[model samples]
Target chain A: MIGLYLTAPYLVYLVIVYAVPIIQGFRISVLDYVYAAPGASVPQPFVGLKNYRKALSDPLLRRSFLNILEFLAINVPLTVILGMTLAAVLAKLSRMKTFFRSAFFVPYVTASIAVIGVWYFLFSQGGLIDHVLGSWAPNPSWLVNSKLAMVVIALEVTWKQLGFYVLLYLAGVLLIPDSLYEAASIDGAGPVRQFRAITVPALRNITILVTTLALIVGANLFAEPYLLTGGGGPNGATMSPALLIYQKGVEQGEPGVGAAIGVLLTLFILLVAGAGAGARRLVQAREAA
Target chain B: MRNGQYGRTLRRLTTYGFVTLGALASIFPLYYMVVGSLQLRADSAFSGLIPKAGNLGLQNYRDVNKAISLLPSLGNSAIFTLGTVVLTIVVGLPAGYALARLRFPGKPAVAGGLILVLVLPFQVMMIPLYILAVRDYGLADNYLGMILPFAVNPAAVLIFRQFFISLPDELFDAAHIDGAGEVRTLLLVAAPLTKPAILTASVITFIGPWNEFLWPFLITKKHSMQPLAVSLGEYVSTNAATAANPYGVILAGACVLAVPVIALFLVAQRYFTSAALGSGVKE
Candidate 1:
């Protein structure tokens, strides 16, 4: 068919690059594969889940996974709430709406490299942040502090992702018929009451979409922590699973274990996404009932 | 009535206050990066939040330009990003068209697969991709190696498919009645209507590779062959010690890497928000 002919190139590409590599990655994970080792000319031998077992047992990996959960806990709600509030405010504005929207979106457009640089200068010893807050906190060395480093990373991610989430929320906000708000106002509902009643319910699907997207993006947190803390802070505090996989697999020359970590991370994302979708469905069905 | 008017005015003022503060928080880092980069080495951290007028200079930028092999890295980024964009449009367009217009075997499977691929992280495929590009085919340090995997972008495909699906079938049938072949009709007719789709896909695709760090770092071994994202990372991390003014030089480097991306976003800003909306894709 003409359709198959048109699709052939892309199907070939997906097979070669995406699908094949995914399958091959599993194969490599199960084998004692070190592609870069000296005289690793022979095919790797099958080790049968040993690499996975080792990755599961790795204290550093466990710590990294725990770090992701902590990040998710703080980041997901903050992003949604902040994003929604900003979108609502922007929607209601009669003046400087475009200016404010563009201003808020600058961070999302800027690359992580530049963004992290500014943050580094801000949080470093004797920097502007320290100069300002030195009296109260007394020179908070952000990158070195284990707990504080993770918190800062979460803040950085939230700031970076806020704009995209805002755009999504704005689109959802625009779809809510103004009549609903008008109706609420006629009933003597204040701004707060109208927002609570009309805005929240109108944004149900968008909220689910944004939250799920946030979860996936949170799980893939690599750039900020990697750039900010040189991949891990003191005591492996700021380490993320993606960072851990890159460190062990690529930096440390243990591809087998790295592939295993990748596999686990994939499964973890699937499980989270599945749970989110199921929860959305249940909530929807309940509301329908 | 006067009291009620005063309360409403007060509420409006507070809302503006909150929005301005949030916007300032969002943009403060970028402002700092620019101001800090322009300041003298000794004056870098000592200055207040607003940069002093007299101390600003381009010395740090000149120093960064000299220190890192910036031109080559930028050129590499250009090649890598431009190559991915062209390839995505070329390959993704036809496939999208096929799914939207032409009847095909296994259509549902392919559509489902595309969505499934969207959910999976690139990290899952990265191991084999690394080996395949680096060792098996000897594409390490080559632009093709860096560009090929990302070129087959699912997001672009989905965007294009969404656009093409909305087009009237009569248009394609008209072309066909005139004895125009599928590729000709596609090139002349179907693809032209998708300017918004093209812009959205190109901008989104451009941003990914332009600011990409990990895979390019993995693929290109030599510093000379590296893209801006990778080289910028290395220069900031390891070579920060070598510069006379670490903050100034590194911030300058960040500026160099960010300027083009920011400019592109500014130019295409209108198209970006509206086009995604037009296509019925929610960001």
Candidate 2:
């Protein structure tokens, strides 16, 4: 009775805010629900699987998903690798550890739009990157070019989020007993060998955690493209599925398509999370064996 | 011994080298933003990687404030973030304590549901929430709509639950012996013991709403009602009037949005690192 009493408020909140919205979202996605405009009457007919089918078939939606995939391919690996490397380096430091950790984390803590502002100037025409590159580079328009814009967004995101994953990785690194490293050193193992043998194996769980997190963050690539490239940029090059959902749902008045896109994005995130969890179980089982 | 000294020196050099370089890369953008904000000239947008003494001023900040409603937006951010922190602590603590201490029948299921909430993205639930807040409740332009959805955070609950579970049972038993009710025992004992947990949860909770753009942006369509994040997003992307001092104004806007959080982080730096390092990531 006490447990139920204590948990009731949170349960109520979850039901209203989270559970209800998700169910409503599923319902909206299957209907032809254009948002009702101010002082206008509109009919929202139940369209069954039409929105999902449209999302699957629509070229822009497909392209948006593809764009996010490309982004994930670059972002997830880069964030995890850079975060892992930096964490390993920071973990070894005996002096000024807090300084470097705090410095890296500043970007992570800052609002995305704020940092996006900083990055926009950095990569725009006659900006720092262009000023450095000079006229030797042909039209060094980072945000203008489709491929390069995606790369820049990835770099910005990786830079911002790297510190967070670093903290997580650092936690994983600290969990490994020092005695193992001492034993490895006594056996004539070098730093690289010790890192590979001890640090990597010990970080199996954390690696999964970081990758899963990075995948989720990468998939929800909205504000960067929205702020930097003006919501999809030149010819919808950097249009992430999240941005697409917003554009179609809110801005363009097609909430059904937006909800359909949301449903798909959730499934993709769940798939990645499931795989990460499964992989962790497999690794742990193997370790036990 | 000589070889060991050499190896140690090399290791130290590599460590400092990588760490310093990474830190510099991390801080360079922020440095540039501040410097660019100070230097108002359009031509010399980035006045060298090293900022000149003469090229700095406070006018652009004033201009940004004039151009957009920076102070009001920041005020909105503060209210929203503070409300979230308060609500998270108020609602999460009891639930977390229950999960930790009480003999709940559906404890395992509740715990699983909390973890599921952590994994689920906000984007997944955006559409329905937007409609509900706007259509059913007519809370589109209100702070309550923005604060309510995120008030009961699963992560805060999980953090508090972990902290409460690790507390000595004797304290609670002693409270019971003194005939203190559950509420009083929780208020007097468990609550006070959770300072570190509170700080951790507060910081974590603060960062989300403080930096959140999408939901606030969606709900509060009116510019005056928007938070700093949404306001900055609008100013940078769409505001045409600020194009006169584009770099300076935009950077100034960025600075306003970032400075508060950055200042808070700097002041409470010790709490952050220790909290993250020591207690987190057991799961």
Candidate 3:
């Protein structure tokens, strides 16, 4: 009875709030749901996988997936490499480490909307970027230019997220024993050689972990693009899968299509996450052998 | 020896130089935001790295206030964030404890499922959740609509569960001998012991609700109901064509929104880093 009392509130909250909605969400996906036609009898017709078929067939959906793929391709590697490099420096720093660490990490803690606000100013016409460009070339309208818009958004994500990756990498680097570096140094290995042999190998798991997280976060890109490009503007140049899902589902009132896209995106994330876990296990086994 | 010393100096200089450049690249956008916010409309046209000190006035700040009810929006954000944090912790703590300590059936499956949920995009589940909220539950444009869906954070529960599992079993046994029930023991014992984990979870929970854009934007259309992020986003989007971008006022707003989390981080920097990184590890 006591145990039941202890667990009841939490159990009830989770079931009612978290689990039920998630399960109900699946059910709603099957129905021809319309938020506006709320009182209509049998509002959502049970159309099994029809939404999924429409979503899969949509060119916008395919394009958004491709856009997310391109974004991940650039962002994942840049953030990881930059983060690892900064972490390496931070690990070696003997003075002002905390200050430097905090400075880099301020962005991660700041609101994403705020960060996007700052970027909007910098990337907009006659803003910082344009100001610089006016010195040499004609000012390009970044928010409207389809090709440049994606790159600008990508850069913004990298800048905001690099600090987080740095912290993660720093934790991994700190775990490497100093004696390993000493041993390499005594063996006539230079700093580069030490890092190549010791730091890289030791940080393998951290790399995989950070990369997977970056990919997941990157795939779910919404606020930045939504705010930055005005909901994937310039003919949908920077539209992510998440934004596409929101636009189709909420704005267009197509819950079925939205759920279908959502499932597809979830599957994509799951495959990446699974591959990462598998890779970590493989690395650990190889190291043990 | 002298040559080697010179080489070491050169290497140190190179390292410092590279790190400094990266740091500047990381922080330069923020610097621009600050400078741009301060400049007058005419000065803003120049877009130089440095702001003309005279052009730095309260005009932007005044404009931002006139344009949006930033203060009220911030209040709404705080209420929502605080409410969400309390709800998550109140519910998450016991559930985490149950999963960690109790020999419940489907424990491993529950644990694994929670982890899977963490990686699943909120976008996918959003439509169904929204339909349930508006159509079935009739929570449209209401605070409950926003709060209920977000209350049970999977990540918080996972972190709390991890922390709970590592706790010494003796504490529970001792409390049990004293005739303290599981609820009493959890409230008095486990909850206090997991301070760092709790604080970390609270900070993250606060940040998510405070910084959340899409959900609030989707759910609430009323200016009174909107939080700081959505309100500010709407303000910027609508006011983009104005001569001066009102950078300072926006920065001020951003700064206001940031202050609590920044302060929390500063107070618990070391523990915050450890807890964040520790919970992130797979094992």
Tens digits of lDDT, candidate 3, A85-151: 8899888887778878877887777788888877776776676667666765333588888777887
Q: What is the lDDT of residue B133 in candidate 2?
A: 82
Per-model B-chain TM-score: 0.90, 0.92, 0.87
Query: What TM-score does candidate 3 get on C-alpha atoms?
Result: 0.90
Runs in model 2 deviating more than 4 A are A37-43, A135-140, A273-289, B43-47, B240-242, B274-282
Candidate 3's C-alpha runs over 4 A off are A1-8, A36-40, A134-140, A271-289, B42-47, B176-181, B242-252, B280-283
- How do the residues A1-289 of candidate 1 rate in per-residue lDDT, one tens digit apiece? 7788888888888777787788888888999986664336867889999999999998988788778778888888888888888889888899998888888877887888888888888877677867777576443377877878888888887898788778778887888899998998899999999888988888777777766666666667777778788777768898888888888788888889989998998888778778888987898899899
List TM-scores for all candidates, in order.
Answer: 0.94, 0.94, 0.90
What does candidate 2's lDDT look like per residue over A1-289, in tens digits?
7788888888888877888889999999999986774546778899999989988887777677677677778887887677778888898898999899899889988989889888887887778887777775336388988768888898888889888878888877877889999999999999889988988778766777767666777667889988898788767788888788888888888889889989998887777678768877897799899
Q: B259, model 1: CA deviation in Å?
A: 0.8
Give the lowest summed-lDDT range of ten residues in model 1 chain B: B274-283
Candidate 3: how large is its RMSD? 3.1
Cα lDDT for residue A272, candidate 3: 64
